[model samples]
Target: MRIHILGICGTFMGGVALIARELGHHVTGSDLNIYPPMSDALAASGIPVRLGYEPKNIDPKTDLVIIGNGIARHNPCVDYVLNQGMDYISGSQWMCENVLRHQHVLAVSGTHGKTTTTALLTWILETAGLTPGYLIGGVPKDFKETSRLGAGKYFVIEADEYDTAFFDKRSKFLHYRPRTLIMNNIEYDHADIFPDIEAIKKQFQYLLRCVPSNGSVIFPNSDTNIQDVLSRGCWSTQMATGDESGWYAKLLTPDGGAWECYFKGEKRALIKWHLVGNHNVQNALAAIAAADSIGVAMHDIEKAFATFSNVKRRLEIRGCVNEVTVYDDFAHHPTAIATTIDGLRKKVGEQRIIAIAQLGSNSMRMGAHGDALSFSFQAADQVHVLRPEDKSWDVAAVLKPLGNKAFVHDSVADIIDVVSKAALKHDHVLIMSNKGFDGIHERLLDKLSV
Candidate 1:
């Protein structure tokens, strides 16, 4: 089938395009922002990408139009699809109807760690020679790609709770039927769409309902948020979170990047992971449980864990100069930021934990999480918030309570200048945002070099 993807520049959409292209479909796409590496990625695949949505781009001969959730009712192409009555469907719906039916899908869903956990789970299966097909939200460093449409009975995907499309407002994951579900912890996110934390939780419950009785859910142990949703109903579920959890994880060496995790407090898997958070320990466990359910041996999982390359931008090192290391993470939510800090603290110890965070994602930029930003940085030695370029709120008011410990600046360049001037000799500078922060990591690395 010839498939045209709307909003192909998004991370998820770009992944879909590649996967569709792999499926031997004639894939064409259009987006408002058509730039590298998405543009470069598509061009390499011999797929022509158009700029901006136009009715003409719809191509009457196209078999199916895969509209990304980012597209809405008003796009000119979308309007034309409606007016002309073209055959189209949401990306998730398309995947459900064509790709996932009758497949044993190992679905990973949560506000945080979905991409990482999905990558880890897929890695375990792939290492065991399972050759599972997968559609991860982020580019896995191990694979150098996000989506794979291969010949395998198992399909692993990062199940999202966000609305499927402007037309289908239900959570996207409901379209996915999983024989095995991993419910990582949930919280308030995408405030632009969901009104409250509970609203988001309700959607998660809906996702949980999709799992069949034969399928078991591996979830975090101590999370009250997960507890609340599970309390409402019963499902085939298991636990994997804390020190005393059902499926426990043991870290062999506490030294920074290398970790050996034990399930049930007995040595299970050993790996050197770049991710720096206890939250990631839980992420690893979720993968272990999913793999065990799928018949992958513990020995193979341990080997895959050792060789697994981390996901892109989750804690990616952009550049390092002078005496400081400049790192990047897509940690926009307050809870995510706090967990990132906790992981770094475990590694760096008393080294000045310099964090430059941006309120860039939809939720952090305009939610009731003004106070969350302050509490999120309790683990950091110094907190610096990039005064939102979005103008979502009075930046001063939202961050005023942090007082002398926190500083809010209006420009990424200004934040770089401050960090460059005052950072300690061995400080680790963390640049946190869901989107690129005007390439602040590069600027800071350059300044620190001098």
Candidate 2:
């Protein structure tokens, strides 16, 4: 089938494009902003891509339009497709019919850990010699690809609860029709979309509604937010664990670098993943439960986790020079930042942790919860707020409470200068942002390399 993807540059949609292309489908996409690494990845896959989205980009040859969640009804091409009554569905819906309708869909959904968990699931399956097809929001560094259309019978996906698209008001995961749903955690997010935490929980309820009776759920036992939803009643089989519960991770120290965690549970020491932090522990436990259900032995699962490199930009060490290590992470939320910091603190003990974050995500830039930015930076010895004058949010007001931990900076150069002046040798400068922050990591690396 010939597939045209709207908003193809988005991480999720881009993976769809790559996987579709690998499946021998004619894949083409249009996005207003097109650049590496997404553009580079798409072009390298030999997929035809249109520079900008317009109604003219669509025609009779297009069999399906994979509308990305990022593209709204107001988008010219989306608006045109809607007006013409064309055959179009969301990325999630399209995946439901084409990629997962008959396969074992291992769906990982949560306010956190979805990407890491999905990647962990894929890695265990791969290391255990199962070539699983997968679509992840973040590119798994080990595979170097976000989507792989392999011959594996299993399909792994990071099941997000965000609304599918403008046409479909339900969360994207609803259309996924998951056979196994890994409910990690849930909380308030996407302020512009859902009105309250309960409103978002309702979407989760709907996702749970779609799980077939034979399917199961894996969740953190200690999360009160998760408990609130689980109390509502679920007929599907379930597996529960917390950081300190039945299935848990014991952090194992490795060499000078890297983190190893042991996944011990009632039946086995299922897995020991190389990823760090409590969040990753939950990620491994969730993946372990899914793997156990699929017949991957506990010990082999542990070996897979022992060597599993994390997804790219998720606590990825970009460079180290003059004893200062720079890391790039895709953590934009407060909880995510805190967890990432905790992980780094353990790995690079006693080093001053310098964190630089950008208010770049739609949720961050929307200004609805600007104050939360302060809480996100509490772990950094010194914090740099990129694009604080983002025009959408009151940056100064948000940083006011943080006092010394936060500082508003316009460019990457400014951040480098502050770090050089204040941070001592062996310090860890961590850069966190979902969107590429003006290629800030490389620029910082170049400055640090000198």
Question: Against the true structure, whose TM-score is highest?
Answer: 1
Q: Rate the local accuracy (lDDT) of all candidates.
A: 0.82, 0.80
User: Residues 284-350, candidate 2, lDDT per residue (tens digit)?
Assistant: 7788888887899877887887788888888888988878888999987778888898888777676
Tell how far residue 277 is off in model 2, in angstroms.
1.3
Candidate 1 lDDT, 2-54, residue by residue in tens: 89999888877888888888878999998988876668777888889898898
Give candidate 1's TM-score.
Answer: 0.94
The number of clashing residue pairs in model 2 is 2
List candidate 2 segments past 4 Å from native.
Answer: 83-85, 243-245, 252-267, 270-273, 370-372, 389-393
**Residue pairs whose backbone atoms clash in candidate 1:** 250-261, 250-262
Candidate 1 residues lying further than 4 Å off, grouped into runs, are 237-240, 243-245, 255-267, 270-272, 389-392
Query: 288, model 2: CA deviation in Å?
Result: 0.8
Give the least accurate 10-residue stretch of model 2, judged by summed lDDT: 254-263
Cα RMSD (Å) between model 1 and the true structure? 2.0
